[model samples]
Structure formats: C-alpha cells, structure tokens
Target: MLNFLKKNIALAWAKRHVSQTENFKNNAEKLQEELLLSLVKTAEKTLFGRSHQFEDIKTIKEFQDKVKINDYEDLKPYIEKVKRGQRSILWPETPEYFAKTSGTTSGSKYIPISKEGMPFQVKGAQSALFHYIAKKNNADFVNGKMIFLQGSPELEEVFGIKTGRLSGIVAHHIPNYLQKNRLPSWETNLIEDWETKVDKIVEETEHENMTLISGIPPWLVMYFEKLTEKHSKKIKQLFPNLQLIVTGGVNYEPYKDKMEFLLGGKVDIVQTFPASEGFFAFQDDYTKDGLLLLTNHGIFYEFIPLEQYGKPDTERLTLKDVELNKDYALILTTNSGLWAYSIGDVVRFTDKNPHRILVSGRTKHFTSAFGEHVIAFEVEEALKSTVLKYPAKITEFHLAPRVNAESELPYHEWFIEFEEEPANLNLFKEELDFQLRNRNSYYDDLISGNILQQLKISKLRKNAFNEYAKSQGKLGGQNKIPRLANDRKLADLLEIYKL
Candidate 1:
C-alpha cells in the first residue's frame, strides 16, 4: 500500500512536470531569462558574484557579458579556497558537501554541492523513475527491491565538509523508507574491495524479489556474469520479476547484446545523462532516439559548436538557437553556483520540440591526429556493425592514433580483449575498417588518399583492462578505461599485456 501510494504521487508529479516541459519549449526564451535572473539575484551577494558584478546583470545578454565561460581550471582556485573552510566563495551558503570525480586532464576534481542544489539532484533522479512509471502506467515494480550497484557511501571530511563519490553522497540521501527496498546494505556498500562487495551483493540479493537494477553498464554486466556463474542459469531464472534496467555513465549500445543474452529475454532499458556536475537528462520516450532535457531544473544551458569549441570567439547558443543533428559542447550556469561552466561533454539535438539530445562524445575523447576526426558515437556504431557481421564479442577495447617516423603512413590502432574471437582474424579487421570508413567520411578520404593506413588490431590477454585498472586503483565504481586516445599512452599500456 505504501509503495502504491508513493508511485501514484510520483506519477502525478511527473505528469505535471512533463506537461510543463511543453511550456518550456514554447517559452524557452522567457524561461531562460527567468532562470538567469534568479541565479544572478541569489548569488549577487556571494564572493564570485561580487567579483563578477552580478548585481548589474538584469538580462541574459548582460549576464553573458559579465561572466566569462569557465572550465574546471577556472574554478579550481575558488574550489580550493572553499575546501579550506572559506564561506560564500562561489555559493551563497557554504557547500554542504563536495563530490569528487577523476578528471581527464587534471588529477582529481572536487565539485561543491550546496544545500539548495542537493534537492535538485535528488528530484532529477526521481524524475527519471517517475517518467518511466508514467509511460508504463504500472507501478508494481515499486514493491520489489531496486538494486543500485554503486560505490562506497563512507565519506571523509575535508575541513568539516563531507567528501566522497557523487553516488556515495546520493546514497546517504536515499529516503529511509526506500532503504529497505534497496540492495547491498550500507555496510556492504562501504566495503572498499569491489570483489568482496560483489560477493556480498550476490549473497544478499540472490533470493530477493529484484524488479529494477540500476548502475553503470560495465559494473552491471560484471554483476550479471557473477550471478549467472553462481546460479548456473540465466538472470531471468534468478529474478523472474525483473522488469527494468536503468543504465548511464557510459554508452550502452556496445553492451546491449551481451546484456540481453545474459538475461535470456528483452527488457526495458532506460538511459540517463547523470554526472557529478548535475543530472542533465533522461530517456523519457520509448523510442530511445534521444533523452529529454530537464529544462526547468534550475540550469541555464549554452551550446558551442564542436568545430568552434576551443576557439576564442565561439558563439554560444541558447535553447532557442539549437538545430537538429549538429554536435555542440554543453555549457551550464546552474543554481549550484556554476556559472558559464563548460562540462566537456558533446551532444547533438535530435528533437527540438521538447529539446531532446543524444550525448555524442566528450570534447577531449575524440581522435583527430591526421585530420580524420573520429568521435565516440561513430566508433561505437562502427564496432556494433562489425560485431553483427562477424563472430566476435568484445569484452573490452581501446583505440589510439599511431604516428611514427618508421611507418610509411599513420594508422588507428585497436587493442581488443575479446570474449569470442572471430574465425578469420583478417576478415574481422577488414570488416571493422570498412565499417569505420563508411561511418566517417574523413577517415574514408584519408584511406583513399593513402594518408592513413588500414586500422591495426592487436588482441590483448583476457582481463587486461581489469588488471590495468586495478593497478591504477580505479578498478570499479565509475572509473572506465578511456576508449579513445589521441596519443599512444593507452596503446603502450595495453601492448604490455598483448596475447
């Protein structure tokens, strides 16, 4: 009865929010103006605001003019100051906590989570489920446990402020009533050893009525493999009532076939765009073409075309100016005191009616060493196409550009640790090269002109990536092997473990 009531209330709230989404599309300019005004007004008294003269910002144009765009480097000084017990530096009130994430260029980053911003993150996550329930029109899944495979909730204090992984901080905020229906109890979650925690999770949930499972795709795949190994049966046999799988933090297309085969049947898959910076978007419709942007979530957005991203005079477009199918880097100015912040992820709008998008790749994750730009989306699609044509299942893989004075031409090198190798290795390479060339015109041109050689493939020993990750102390919980590198750093590392 409690679950039913909660579902109904949540569904109603989600339906209302969905209705409001249309209003956001229709009056996007007005909504953006209001959001910008609210942010400026609220932070006008804070240190960052005073330094930037936020008091003079009464319009979007004024706000943009006064505040320069920023990446993590620009805010590192303020973040460090706040960590030293400083108050009102970036936020109106001191941050309640800090969420730490591994930075790509930098070592580690600490993101402040103000008290006011906490609810927005919580609400954004809840909105995902609510949207799912509203679309499915069934809430029976709420009765059973929802297993969230996540990192440790154990937190440390940095100058009296709690600091941990974003998911760990979120775990502490899980409502008391729902705690009974979530998996791997706080104790198990706190276990730092991923292997031990996975065992505890398997022991704790092997017999429970699990209806929903949510986590990053790779970790969930690991859990499912473990469960199948332990039970000697498909996951559907163990959890007959399992109905939904919610995944994010990485693309799911590459893992879809393996995940479904493990389950023995098709299941509802919902993708989300959640990050330590903010909960930005979620899969709302069943079509799965793109994610619906959370327009009213106290985040004002800007988009810079991928080609113009790092250029000095790049034009930033608001919601009203975005076009379909053009890749753009996402920028945000939020209620959490992140002003004109570039989050580094690239996205392309799929639908402009309600502003839906597909995350294409990271600004720093692409490879364009020889003028043949290859983004993550194209690489994933190419791999998926190749796998469908050949008898292969990729367990893990990484790509990097190889340019050497000894070689006649530059080439893209692939280091693959395969679960199932193809019958003809040469054919597999040819098919992969063909697929990538067809997907990327620039690559095709380079090959045609002999500027780039055929892609090189190297098979790595089994569990090579896992061993490398463990060595780096990033074995589990949101840390993923970088899929593409402009240089040979990853290739050199994987070469050491070649089969």
Candidate 2:
C-alpha cells in the first residue's frame, strides 16, 4: 500500500514537471538567449572569459562572434589549469566534480560539472522518467527493483575535486526516494571489471521484481544474456513484473528486434541521449520516433550543417534557424564552463514546435574513403532494414573501408557479430547493400561508377566485439564499437575475430 502511494506521488510530480516543459518549449528561443547570457555573465571574470571578452557578450550574435567554435584541443590549456587547481579558469569557483572520459589523443579529458550545472544533469535523467510516467500514466516501476548498468561508482581525486566516469558520477546522485528501489549493492557496483560486476549483479537481482532497467543497449543486452543464461529462462519468464527499459548512447534500431526477442513479452522502451558533457535529450512520447531536445537544460545549443562542418567560416545555427531532417554537427555553450564546445555528435531535428531530434552520427565517426561519406545512422539503418526481412539477431558490428583489398575492389567492410546468424548470408549482404545505396545517393553513385565494389560483410564469432573491447581495456562503461572508420586501423585489428 505504501509503495502504491509512493508511486502515485511520483506520478503526480512527474505530470507536473512534464506540464512545465510546454511553456519552456513555447518560449525556448527566449529561454536559450537568457541561458547563454547568464552563463557568459557568470564566467566573465574567469580566465577564459577575460581572454575571450565574455563581458562584451551582450547579444547572441556577439557571443558567437567573440567565441569561435572550439574543440577539445582548443580548450586543453584552460582545462589543464583547472586540473591543477586553478580557480576561475573557465568559470567562477572551482568545479565540484570533473567527469573523466577516454579521449583519442589527450589520453583522458576531464569535463567540469559545476555545483550549479550538476543538477541539470541529474534532472535531465529524472525528467526523462517523468516524461515516460506522464505519457504512460504509470509509475508502478518505481515500486520494483531497478538497475542501471554503468561504471563503478568509486572516485579518484583530481586536485581535491572528485573525478570519475560520467555514469559513475551520476550513480552517486540517484535520489534518496529511489535508493531503496535501485539495484546492485554498493559492493557489486564497486567492482571494476565489467565481466565480474555483471556476474555479481545477475546473482543479486535475478529473483527480484525488477521493473526497470536502464543502460546502453549493448551492455543491457549483455546483462539480459547473462540473466537468461543463469536462470535458463527468458526475461519475461524470469522477471514477470519487469515493465520498463531505458536505453541510450547508441541507436536502438539494429538491436531492437534482438532485444524484443530476448524480452519475450511486452515492455515499454524509453530512449535517451546522454553524454559526459550533459544529458541532451530523451524520448518524450512512446509513440514518437525522436527524443525531445531539452531547451531549458542550462546548455545553449548551436548546429553547424554537416556539409560545411570542416570548412572555414562555417555557419552556426540556433534552434530557431535549424531545418528538419538535415544533419548538423552539434555544438554547445554550457553553464559548466564549456564555451562554444564542439560536441562531435550530429543531430537531425525531427520536429520544430516541441524541438525533438534524432542523433544521426558523430562528426568524426564516418566512412568517406571513396567520398561517399557514410555516417553511422546510414549504416545502422541499412542493417536494420536488412534485418527486418532477413530475421537475424546482431550482437554488435563495426564498419571500416577495406582500401587495400589485394584481390578485390576497395569496399566498405562490415565486421558484424551476430547473436544468430542468418541462413542466407549472401542475400542478407545484398539487401543491406541495397538499403545503404537507397539511403545514401553518393554510395550508390560510387558503386555504379565502378569506383567501389558492393560492400562486403565479415561475419564475427559470438562475443567477438565484447572480447575485442576487453582486449582494448574498454569492455564496458560507455565504450562503444567504432561504427564507421575511414581508415583500416580498426578493420585490421578486427580481422582475427572474423568467423
């Protein structure tokens, strides 16, 4: 009875919170303008501010003119100063925490979470649940055990400020009300080895009335696999009460069929778009295809059209200026002291009134070896299209251009690890190729012009991608397989795992 009452209270609060967003969405432009000015004014006296003249950022256009789009390399110096305990380097007051993330060149990058900015990160996640609860008119999941497969919550200090992976950092902030319902004991969560931690998690919650599970799709698939294996039963058979799943980090299309098959019953799905930088958006309606972009989340957003991304004097458009369906590289100026930061992700707006979006691809993660410029969204959708007809289950996959195929024409090489291999591999490949061509005209032109061969698929052994990630010291915890690479580095590395 108490649990039921608690759920009703949560539902009421969620409905209210969701209702509040209607006004924010209606006045998003005005709100975003105010947010940017507020951020600039707060940081104006800081080191980066003083240099960039943030005090003169009285208008949005002026702010953009003063602060050029900046990548991580551009802000490294100021970040290093913050790491060494410099006060007011980027924003007033030292950051309360630094979210550590793996970097390609910098080894590790520490993103600040100001005392003020941290709530938005926490609330963004909460609001996602609120959206779900309000839309579905149910919060019964709040009464059951919920688990978020994530990084270890243990923290290390960087100059007296706590530092850890974004997931780990967020784990510490799970609300007091939800504490009892949250699963995986603190000791198990502290286990660093993802393989070992998953085992412990399975043992701890296999019999619980697990109603909600949240994590990236790949890792959640891993957990579900382990759970089903241990109990020798499907998810529905094991946890009959399980009702909700929240997933993020990657597109759910490729894994959707497999995940549903594993579940073996009906369960509501919620998608989210979160990063170390911030929680950007989440699925507002179960019926909608895209996530509702958080306009009031203390992050001012800018979009650079993908075609003009790398060129000099690129145009940056705000939400008011963006068009539907066209891909744009996302940029952000945040209260966390990240100014004009290039977030590297590409997004396509799906709606204008409520400003919903789909994460299309990464700015850097693409295959343009033959000038086709195939993005992650294209490849994932292609595979999804094929899977719908072929009926195969994918564990994971990666795409790379095989430029130096000695005996064959240079082609896109897809290394796919399938949970269940299709009976007709050749037909599946052809369909996938066809789907890709349909989605990307450039790829079709290249194939027709004899510049490239039809793309090739290299089947991978079960758990090949998992093992590869483990070998690379990135088996889990926000590490995702490279969906597309222009070069052969990842392709060469994955060659040995091919079946």
Winning candidate number (lDDT): 2
Give lDDT for model 1: 0.86
Residues 1-499, candidate 2, lDDT per residue (tens digit)? 8988989999999999988889887988889999899999998899999999988889999999999999899999999999999899998989889999888877888999998889988899999999889988998998899998889899999999999988989999999988988988999989999999999999999889999999999888889999888878999999999999999998887778879888999999999999888889999977888898998988999999999998989998998999999999999998889999998999999998889999999998999989999998888888888888998888888899888889878998899888888889999999999999999999999999988999889999988988888999998886888788988888888999988
Cα lDDT, model 1, residue 398: 91
Regions of model 2 farther than 4 Å from truth: none
Model 2 lDDT, full chain set? 0.90
Which residue pairs in candidate 1 collide? none
Q: Which residue runs does candidate 1 get wrong by more than 4 Å?
A: 1-22, 405-407
- For model 2 the TM-score comes to 0.98
Candidate 1 shows a clash count of: 0
Pick out the ten consecutive residues of candidate 1 with the lowest summed lDDT: 17-26
User: lDDT per residue, candidate 1, 150-264, as tens digits?
Assistant: 9999999999999999999999888775687899788999998887888899999999999999999889888999999999999989999898998888888888878988999
Supply every candidate's count of residue pairs whose N, Cα or C atoms clash at under 3 angstroms: 0, 0
